[model samples]
Target chain A: MLALIRSEWLKIRRSVIWLLLLVSPGLAGLIGLFGVREEQPGGPFPWLIALALMTALHAMLFLPLLTGVYAALVCRYEHAGGGWKQLLSLPVTRTRVYIVKFLFVMGLVALTQLLFLAVLLLIGTAKGGGGAIPWSELLGSVGRGWLACLPLAALQLAVSTAWSSFAAPLAVNVVFTIPNMLVANSADYAPYYPWVQPLLAMMPHQNGYDFGAFTLPSLTLLSVVMGSFVVFFLGGWAYFARKAV
Target chain B: MSLRILSAELLKIRRKFIWFLIFLGPIGVVGLQAVNFGLRYDYLVGKVYRDDLWGGLIENVTILMVPTLFIGLAILASMVAGIEHQTNSWKQTLALPVTRTQVFTGKFLLNLLLLLVSTTLVAAGTIVLGIVLGFGTGIPYGVLLKACYYPFLAIVPFIALQNWLSVTFQNQAFPLTVGIAGMVVSMFSIRFGDWFPWKWPYLINAAKEPLYSVACGLAFGLVVLAAGLAHFVRKDVK
Candidate 1:
């Protein structure tokens, strides 16, 4: 497992996935710096507004979409020129390899979330936000949002494993991801929809503005996130375990 | 320019899930509008009385279509290139009698044609969606078609740029990420001046005269295409 994780980490150094990280946070920062915020300059509790806007673009579409990209890339080399045959011929169990790749994707997503957090703080300070940073609230939302992405990461990994064409999994993810804007709007549908969960977790219910993250308990949120995560992870695991590759 | 290469490219995309993707965007856009109108018919028609509901429907559809168009083009470009990239077959394709420029042009044109087909579906689907919701006979065909199409005309520059990026990079993630970022920025593109290509799709609708975006799209598209083709032609094919 350790060896597998190390190899995955090394593969990323040559890949541009890290550079892709800068896109969403960078765009969100531009949006925060330029767009008019609801909070008066230096008003009390300014974190939520910046977070609200940033996460709307960040977690809602980009995060999930990025997950699919990362997942596909994780398997990109393996799909090329019998790389999978080379890798699997080794003694390592397929389960461990799958778990490690999934972990790497989750780690990449965490890095993205942390980048979002860093950008959030930088934007707040740059704008001369009045109050002290809402460290607990900001961290809490960001963490919850990352937690919500577990199921997505698992599912994307499965699809990426299934498809050799790099863009096919992404196409699948995008078709699902684009609807987050509309799905997140419907109170009846938002909670049940997996793609919309990260956005729901990141923004407080009151700030949702028809985002429909309201009235959900943390325990229920946790169960739903973990429940879907298990289903996807196990399904992907089963598929890979039996896959001809 | 060779009919041989162009037809070959079209044949390659069959059974490759590309057709489903071409159909997905139009249907998804129309489907979302159906839900929107179905649930809130009273709010859309009743509360905003005297406002042409057809115009309102187009407005709502534009918001969805603009992003869909941006992201869709990028994926199409990447998938087109990926057909070769997955097996390191660029050398195989370029070694043919066709010039590299011809191959690149074929991919870009096929993508543009696919989007054109999708856009027509959007126009047709929107009309059907409106009629199904009883939008009545006063269909604003001219404005609806313009709303559906002027953006495609104006967005040719972006099509070139996305094809450029996708062709240059073997990994599709970079181009796809850029496309998503473009989508995010396009949410704010209405505030952008006419010069920005990403803004052109949405701006075509808002501009008093739609031709402004058309001129920009064509002029910029050729330059980008030439630049991309030059790089593609000169670069060492792996």
Candidate 2:
């Protein structure tokens, strides 16, 4: 399993996809530099406000969409010609292969979240945010957002695994993603929707409400996230196990 | 011969979902508007649509369509190019008795035609939506047509850029990422001013004088398409 995971790492270490990973952090830094002001309308801390805006951009669109791209690309080489047949014909189990790829994608997502954290702090200090860095809150937001992306990543991996054409899965993901503006606003639908979970979880809920659209993560919301993650992860695993190479 | 390539390009995507996407692009945008209106018909009818039902709908729909247009073109270009890339058909297709520019022009036209249909659908759907919502037939035919096509004309350069990237890279990742990035940037492009390429689609909408973005789109589109043609013509296929 470890070697299989290593092989997965070797597959994408030099690909152009890593450059795509920088988009979230790059955008965060840009927003921090421009969009946020010293004294803003929403809250007290400029850094926190910047963080909130950054979370909205990343969590709503970038995180969910990039999850699809990464999952598709991980399966890219395999989908090209005979990579899948050759790998599956080897002396390894399909279960391990599926698990490793999902874990690998989660790792990529975690790295993106961490990069956002790093950029947040870097921008805060560079802008001379006049207070101690809010380490615990930042870490909590990063971790929560990363957690929210799992079901999305898993489902995207399944679709990517099923389709050889990269853009189809991506197109489907993009269609679903376009509605974040509407979907994230619905108290009834936001928790049930996978794409908006990261935005809901990552944004620091003020007085426990999201501009009157949603509240901070409650028990039901957390369960919904975990529930979808299980369904998608297992569904992808089963499909890969029986997938004809 | 160029017409033949255009027809051939259309044939290549026959069994594919590009056609559905061509339709889906506008439908998705219109459908989102449907839901938005369905959810708040009372509020919109009472407050937002006081005097101008069609105008209010037009404004909301235009804002919604730009991001969809940006992302949809990226996918369309990627899929169009990926047909050659995924099956490694570039060499075979190039071996045909045609100039590379014809082939390049053919694909760009297909992308343009697809989006053109989608854009028209948005206009038609907006009308249908207005009629259904009882917006009272004060339909400004010229205004609706201009509202849709102006943005379509303004975004021609991006369609060119997306095709260039999609054709250049065998991997669809780059073009698709750029597409999403452009979408993100365009969401905020209003802040960046009018000259930013991604901002073109939204910039010309409802403007008093709206020729700038269209002119820029045509000129820059020619440049990017020519640059891509040069690369495609010279680069060895292997």
Candidate 3:
């Protein structure tokens, strides 16, 4: 698994996709700065809320798309370069290869979320003075957001790997994101849509730490991640194992 | 020969799973609008955000979905062009009797058609939501058409931009990133309004009253499209 991950990392380092992964989060953060500038100071929350919302919107719409494209790009290394046959020809099990690849992709996405948070933290601190930052809230939001996106990341990896078309998974993300955003607003549906769960998890209800209401979201997200991982990993293994170069 | 190449390229796109993305675009938009309508119907029962269904459609659908839609179109367009690069199939395809221009045009036209189909679904969905919400009766047909026309027009340049990027980069991420970055910039650029092409699509979709600015939009789209196609045809593909 570690070897596979190293190989995947090496491949990622060689591609233009890495540059994009690095730049997109920073660009999104810079865009957040503009939103912060425009925020009305007299508003209920600090100007940081606007920045947070902007960052969240960018993440919601683009993050899955990025993951889908990256997964597909990584999968392409095997499919197009005759690397799959070479890798499988070795003693390594097909399931192991799939697991490692999936883990690496998921790790990359998690890193992206972290990088985005880092950019936000840096900006927030710079603008709000050093110690005025809401470290706990920001860290909490990042943790929940990453957890909530686990299912979505798994789903995207599966779809992109299965289809091997950059557009297919991205299209799926786009189609689902709209509903995710809309359904997320309602208390009843927010639990089921894993895409929206991250944002909802980070939102504070009227009551403090409404874990009872959040239980469903937590369970749903966990189920989705596990379910999707099984299906996608099995599916990818099947394809990677039997596919002819 | 051109028609043969065009048909073949279209056939390739049809076979790819990306077609599902195209088909799902409008359906997704419409479905979300229905949900939004259902969720906020009580609050918006008799409220007037603007004069007609155009206003309602603008208020409900355009602001939220257009950015996603544009992103979708750009990514799809890029993938359609870039897949050849990823798979090293461009050389194979180009070695055939087809000219590069025909291949590019065929794929470009297919993307445009898909965009239209997706936008049309969104329009129909918006109108349906308007009626269901009891807001459709007050809207004039011209207002609704005008409202729908702007988003479609606004997406033209983006489609063109994606075409250029996809053809140039052969990596779908490049164009996708641009689409996302452009969307983020447009959110901030909304204050500038007329001068910014990035915000034009959303503004056009969000425009309440029928105005002459739409002509500017159409003209801008045509210019961008022509420039994009020109750049695409002249550029050499690896």
* Cα lDDT tens digits for candidate 1, A1-245: 88888888887876798798788888888877776464655555456777877777787788888888888889988887888888899889999999999998888889888998898888787776645887888899889988999999999999998888888898888888888878877777777778888888887555544435555777877888899999999999999999998
- State which candidate has the highest DockQ: 2
Supply the TM-score of chain A against the true chain A for every candidate structure.
0.94, 0.93, 0.78
Candidate 1, residues B195-222: lDDT per residue as tens digits?
Answer: 6678777754455677787777788889
The TM-scores of all predictions, comma-separated, are 0.94, 0.95, 0.82
Sort by DockQ, best first: 2, 1, 3
Q: Which one is best on lDDT? A: 2
Which pairs clash (backbone N, Cα, C closer than 3 Å) in model 2? none
Instruction: Give native contacts recovered, as a fraction, per prediction.
Output: 0.62, 0.64, 0.49
CA RMSD, predictions in order: 2.1, 2.3, 4.5
What overall lDDT, based on C-alpha atoms, would model 3 receive against the true structure? Answer: 0.65
i-RMSD per candidate, Å: 1.1, 0.9, 2.4
Q: Give lDDT per model, in order.
A: 0.84, 0.85, 0.65
Q: Local error of candidate 1 at B67, Å? A: 0.5
Q: Would candidate 2 be rated incorrect, acceptable, medium or high by CAPRI criteria?
A: medium
